[model samples]
Target: MPSEHESFNTRMAKAMNDRDFQAYEALLTDDYVGEYPQSGEVIHGPKNARAIIEYYPGTLPRDTLDLKSARVGATEARWVRTPTFTVVRAEGTGNVGFSAMQSRYPDGSTWWVINFYELRGGRLARSTTYFAPLFEAPEWRKPYVEQRGPTADR
Candidate 1:
């Protein structure tokens, strides 16, 4: 069983992954703040969650969320009509962008976004994130990369 605090963080993460702006907004504290140090972008409160959705643009295809766990239960379909809800997500942060090749970043592809969160009052007080599209190590870098240790034959 998870504590309420852990549950809150999980809900916030899920809302972000699902592109469920409404659910995400509910998880933010009144003073919630999000920052991208690489990009020097700051967004405050629940209103800013929209920016995330706009930039990602359904970037996360499959959603594995338990909406019932959220602090504010907003149905996916109804939230669309709410004015605050925007199809916004973060754009390329600093030097990073979504993807040049649509084929490479297909609907269900994995683009990793790592978030470091600080919780306050059982809600998201602040969070910092970095995102990058997943890719195979290039042939050129393989030489510089460390090789795995040899293992006994299975």
Candidate 2:
């Protein structure tokens, strides 16, 4: 059986995937703020609820359900709002975050993603993630950047 923390994370993910605002409301703190770092968008309260409803199922899933979420503000992992449950950072026990390029689906294309979540009182206090499809850098910018990490196989 999953621990309560583990189960909480699972429920929130399901709510987002299923676009169940009420379920999410049950899991997220009433303040519930989500940030889209790439676009500098901040969604809060009822609007955040709407994002889960109108945005996820209606818009985001059409492109990628695997995308990570929010920046979590005060919050800004300066280590951000003190995470409570994160699958990537603390393996869903506490504090979750990861930046990786990986296959989100079996035999599917890879994506670049970063995600972090914070938990408070068994409910999500705040969370954030960013996602981008993998692509090769053009020759034009190669000289301006230094190589880093093990290169991903083409």
Q: Which candidate comes out best when scored by lDDT?
A: 2
Clashing pairs in 2: 69-128, 69-129, 70-128, 70-129, 71-128, 73-76, 77-80, 84-119, 86-96, 89-97
lDDT of 1 by residue, 41-144 (tens): 98887776666663543232234434333212235643211111111222233222221111112233444455666666555677787655556656688778
Query: lDDT of all predictions, in order shown?
Result: 0.50, 0.52
TM-score each candidate. Answer: 0.51, 0.49
lDDT tens digits by residue: candidate 2, 12-63: 5556544455676777678877777999977686456655454421233323
Q: How much is 73 displaced in model 2, in angstroms?
A: 35
The alpha-carbon lDDT assigned to residue 154 of candidate 1 equals 6
lDDT of 2 at 54: 49
Candidate 2: 10-residue stretch with minimal lDDT: 80-89
